[model samples]
Target: MAEPRPRVWVSQPLIDAVIEPLRAQVELITTDEVTAWTAEQLAARLADVDGAIITLNERVGAAQVAGATRLQVIANVGVGYNNLDVEALSAAGIVASNTPDVLTETTADLGFALLMAAARRITESERWLREGQWGQWSFQTMLGADIHGSTLGILGMGRIGQGIARRGAHGFGMRVLYHNRSRLPEAAEGEVGAQYADFDTLLAQSDHLVLVLPYTASSHHIIDAAALAKMKPTATLVNIARGGIVDELALADALATGRLAAAGLDVYEGEPAVRPELLALHNIVLTPHIGSASLATRKAMVQLAADNLLAALNVDGAAARMPSAINAEAAFAARTASGDKSKKR
Candidate 1:
């Protein structure tokens, strides 16, 4: 008898062209509709599968993997992997991967678009006009901030951050300032035309502030009421990073009371369910987390994820072969220590 083919579960409906090839070599189980899977549902699906291709919506941790003895890999469709407990996945000998570089430029484009929209009050002006309020044009009808020759502050200067910096410095002729855990090398900084600044300095000097930092225990609520107090009342804020970094209530208060000029947010703490306070405000621009929503970029993300899943599942020396495996080394170490050499691919 032939050995059973590896079982792989796809947690959401992905592009058919990107996913169809997997059926040739694996027993592919897929979800047609989007699902907010419960923890129990996650564990149950993982229990019998050898691998899974999941999106940001699925949160997996120790409990989800406790019974997933056969599970070997998880390929996350997005760059951010906060949805997965990487430590737990590594300890359980499961390699995890994500699509990163492919979406960098696209996400950066959206971030800058949001920054321009909020700073210029583009969306707000359109909404007012649509409400038939633009009876006549006046010089000060919708006076908004200027983009060029302004100071642009960016937090968390990674690839996307660098992209934003380049756009601000070279394209918009803006003064670019960035704050990160460590300063970028002189050459990299020069290339992006950005200067390093302390946290407070970045906050105080910026005409437009963009948050592109990762979400972690230390980063959570980093931009709370106190931080907001430090920013210029005329400054515009844009968050293309995770939502948990800002306090929604405090942010709403700032916009409502004119403590800050305006804010553009793509991600929210409880996403798809924005705070009512934010919804009621007109100064803030809200988007449904479409940072990398372009067709080409989304397809690339799915393709990269599929490539990672297949490589980690069927390729010889799977760990080293995965394109963007996050915890392959640690996962392989755990497997080796457990005397699971027979299962090592």
Candidate 2:
């Protein structure tokens, strides 16, 4: 008799092209629904599966991992794996992976688009015109900030950040200043025509400041009232990064009182439910988190994640694993240390 094929579960619907290869190799269980699962539902479904392809909506934390004793790998469809309790999964000896480089340029494009929309009041002006407010064109009817010859500040200098800088420096003829944990090498800096700026300096000097940082414990709410107060009052703020980096309530208040000129947001702290105040304001540009929503890019992301899943599950003829596996051993160690700290406290 032949050996049983490894069982794979897809938590959400993915492009058929991306999953067809996997289906051929495994006993596939899939769902067309995009809804999130309850803890009990996730636990029950994972009980017998050997691996899973999950998206950002599902939380694959300690509880789910504990229930899925046979599970060995999880491939996240998105670049950000914050929804996964990585440390817990690592400790359970379960390999976890995400799609990264594939979506960098596409996400950067959305970031720059949002920056332009916010600066030029694109969405707001369009809404006003649609509401029958455009009787006639008047001088300074809908004046907005310029992109060329302006300083663009970036909060994070990751791959996506670098992509945005390239567009600003080469395409728009804008000065770029970036603040990150570490500065890029001189060669890279010269290539992108970007300069390193301290956080406060970047906040103060930039005509338009964009956040492209990740969400980590250290980076949570990096932009609060104090940080916002340091920014130029006339400057526009754009967040294409994770929503936790900014205090949305504070941002709404600032925009309402003209403490800041205008704002744009792609991600929210508690997503799928935006603050009512932000929706009411005309000085802000809001979008559902579609930073990497391009058809080509989304397809690439799904394929990349599928590849990672196949390799981790040791499927024959699958793509190679990502060079960086997030260092599972290190993650376990960090979690142990955190638990010890908590116990002592």
Candidate 3:
């Protein structure tokens, strides 16, 4: 009997180009319709699969990982891997990878676009015009804030944050202030023309504050009621990061009472369905999480993720095994030496 080819499952329908490269290498299973799958459904499909390519839609926590004992790798299609319990995957000896770097500039561009849209009430003004509400050219009919010469505050100073800061400083002549886990070196700061500020100072001084931090347990709802209270009443809030980073209810309250001037949200606490309160307000702008939605960028991201999947599954002769496996023996050794302290984090 011949050895069976590895079975691969793609959780969602991806661009044809992404899958075309994998077709000849494995027994591929994929869906044309993109929909959220239940845990049971995921478990059912995971059975007998050696590798899987998934998106942020499915929650691949401990249960799903444990059920797919034969599974060796999970190639996540997005930069954010919050949907996957990485610690659980690591413990299960499953290699998990994501598409990063490639989407950084594109996502940052969207973040800046959202900031400009929110500051100028772009969507609201368009709606008003479409409704034939522009009966007269009144001066104060749809007044909005100015972006240039304003203070742009950023929550996360990662690569994407630096990109936004560069755009603001160079393109818009905006003063940029950022709060990060650690300050960037002086040369890097000079390049972006950004100044490091404390969390409270960043919140209080910014004309437009944007969140681009990752989602972790410690970072959950980092922008809650107290954080909102710290910001300027006339400040605008823009979130292009993970949904759980901001408190939706508190944000709605802040926007409702004019505690904050306006908001531009690309990601919501519970996505696909935004809060009713936010929907009713005219001061906020909502998008369906399309930060990396440009045609070229989307294609590149999908291709990179497909490459990662193929590499992790060792499908192509040119592909390497999952990078995580290189350190797996070290992990096991450290676990034995440290009495299983390897999983503590």
Candidate 4:
């Protein structure tokens, strides 16, 4: 009798060209629509599959994985895996991977675009024009902040943050200041033309400040009322990071009261359901989470995730070839110990 092929599940509707090829090698279970899977559904679906490819919308945790006896790997299409309980996955000996580098430049482009929009009042001016308010052009009409030769501050100096720094310093002739948990080396800083600053300094001195940090417990509500008060009142604040990083109510208050000049956001604390407070304000530019939404970049992300899923399932080689497994080492160690115990029994 021949061995049954590994069964894999694709949790969301993905680019067909990138995901369809997996069908030839494995018994593929796929969804054609974007489904909001419940915890019970995820637990039941995962119980029978050996591996899964998921997007950020699906949250997998201890309860979801409790009955997943045959599950071995999960490949996440986005860089941020806050939706996945990594600790639980590691404890269960299930390796997890995320697509990171492929989306860096694309996301950085969106961040800079948002900064320019907020600084120049692009979207707000457009709305004004659409409302027939541009019939007479006044000298003070839509006066906004300058992007060139201004101080650009970045809260997290990761790959995306450095990309923004390069654009600001080299392309726009702006001074770039970055605040990170750790400072970069001299050569790396020179390449991006970025200077390291303390967090408060980054807020007070920046004409335009962008947040690119990951979301952790320590980072939640990092930009609250107190933090916003530290910023220059005329500054532009942009957040392309996780929504929880900024206090939404505080941000709305600042924008509404002119405590801050203008703001732009791509992510929200409760996304796809933005607050009426933010929508009612004219000084803010809002966009759905599309940081890595370019066609080329999104395809690259799905392809990388497919590669990770295939490698982790040992489709062609050993289960250790996943390119970006977050917990590969620990998961493999746990699996090894479990196998040894089974053999002893």
Candidate 5:
């Protein structure tokens, strides 16, 4: 008998172009609402699907995936898959893929934008102008830090971090310094004119600092009151990374006191629900996590995820390339093994 068409659950609606390719090989149950799906809803939606395409909004942990008996893969559109518990997914013999390279440059662009906005007081100045405060111009009115010929510090040195370093070093004539879990090789550092700095040095020396690290237990609150205290009083801080990396309460305190110059945050610890302390601060710029929000980049991310989903599900003649699976080996093992069909890997 012919194999039955795979049933897939799409967490959110995608543009027609991104979704069309999968229409022929998969039966899709897609949600039209942009709102995030609750745990119960996810359990119900994913119960019988062979695969799923999810976004950051969906939090899939052990409990969430407990009932996903038929689920073979979960493709995420964004580079970060913290939303989906990889350990749980791998244990379930389910392949989980994320779109990474496609959104690297786009996210880097936002990181730089946030850096400049925080350094130059762009958002604050705009609010001032809109409030009709532009009537008088003084020598020091709205004066802010300069990006050119300044030190640029990055907390994480991944692809996105490297892109930001290149822009700062080559385009702005800034000294780029990065601190990662492990230092990059000399050649890689030379490519971006970046130097490896210890965490404390990166905080103290940078005239403008940006956080681009992943969200992990170790990384959570890596930037706290003490870290903020190490920074120069006039330095600006920007976080394009996850919110939990920085203690939001400590950050707001720093910005409120004259200890730090200003801050720009694209992601918040609570997410979608920012701390009221941050909102009350005037020297900060807040964005609702639009790092990869560009029209073209978003489209590309969706397309890449769709392609990976197809490849992972092995739709007939779908190229069958392994998706950007975090646990590709385990997934392949699952495919090859005929015995021990337990949910956990």
Candidate 6:
């Protein structure tokens, strides 16, 4: 008799090119609709699968995984896994992994694009011209801040942050400043041509500030009205990080009252739903969290996630090759403890 193939659930349809490998080897369950899932909905689906490939939209926590007795692994399709309760997964002896390197450059490119677009009022001008409001050309009509020779401040100095720093320093003639929990070493600073700044200094000194920090308890609403008050009134703000990192209501007030200049945002708190106040502002540019949305990059992310799922499931051809597991130690420790108890029994 043949052994039963492991079942894998896909939260949503993935890139067509990356689905073939998964289809050939696993008993697959998948969804075509981009429907939002409540924790209950996700738990219901995960209860019977050995593993699952999911996106950030699915918030998988302790309660959500309570019914998932057979689940062993979760493969997140994006670099940020803030939506996942990793501690809960670790306690369940479930290994959770993410796709990181594949999206770094793509996300960084989008970050810089948003920075420049907001700084120079590109989208606003386009709207102005389209509205037949370009009848008169004045010297200062659409005058905007210059990217060249500006001071660029990055709030988080990870791989994507380093890429943005390189673009600002090497591609353009901008002075790059960065603030992380700890400063990068001198060697790394030189490679990116970036200087270290304290948080308050980063806020005050930068001509344009970008947020790229991961979402965490300490980082939620890190940028609030109080923080925004420290920024230059003429400076621009860009957030390609998670939405919870910035207080959206405070941001709206700042932009509406001219407390800050212009702004750009890719992610939002409770996303796919924008605050009506932000939508009313013409000085802000909003994107639907597509920092890693390039066709090639999206494909790479799905493939990497599939590889992680395969390895974590102990699937053939992917043996002993766990890639990008965030809580590998915890998962392994729990597994070992389970084995020890089983041997005694």
Decide which is better by lDDT, 4 or 6.
4
Clashing pairs in 1: none
lDDT (CA) per prediction: 0.93, 0.85, 0.83, 0.92, 0.87, 0.90
lDDT of 5 by residue, 1-345 (tens): 876788888888776687766778898887777967789988888888888998898999878878887888899989988888887877777889999888899999999998888889999999999999887879999989999999999999999999999999999999999999999999999999999988888998999999999999999999999999999999999999999999999989999998899999999888889999999998999999999999899999998888888887777855566647677677556645835352321
For all predictions, the C-alpha RMSD in Å is: 1.6, 5.0, 4.0, 2.0, 2.2, 2.2
Model 3: CA > 4 A from native: 316-345
Give a tens-digit lDDT track for model 3, residues 189-294. Answer: 9999999999999999999999998888888999999999999998999999988999999999999999999999999888878889889999899999988888
Clashing pairs in 6: none
Ranking by TM-score: 4, 1, 6, 5, 2, 3
Ranking by lDDT: 1, 4, 6, 5, 2, 3
Per-candidate TM equals 0.96, 0.93, 0.92, 0.97, 0.95, 0.96
- Candidate 2 structure lDDT: 0.85
Once model 1 is optimally superposed onto the true structure by TM-score, how far is the C-alpha of residue 175 displaced, in angstroms? 0.4
Q: Write the per-residue lDDT of candidate 2 for residues 30-85, one digit (tens) a residue.
A: 99878679988888888888788888888878998776667767888898999888
Off by over 4 Å in 5: 317-319, 332-345
Runs in model 4 with CA error above 4 Å?
318-320, 340-345
Q: Distance from true position, residue 133, model 4, in Å?
A: 1.4
Worst ten in a row by lDDT for model 5: 336-345
Per-residue alpha-carbon lDDT of candidate 6 for residues 179-235, written as tens digits (9 for 90 to 100): 999889999999999999999999999999999998999999999999999999999
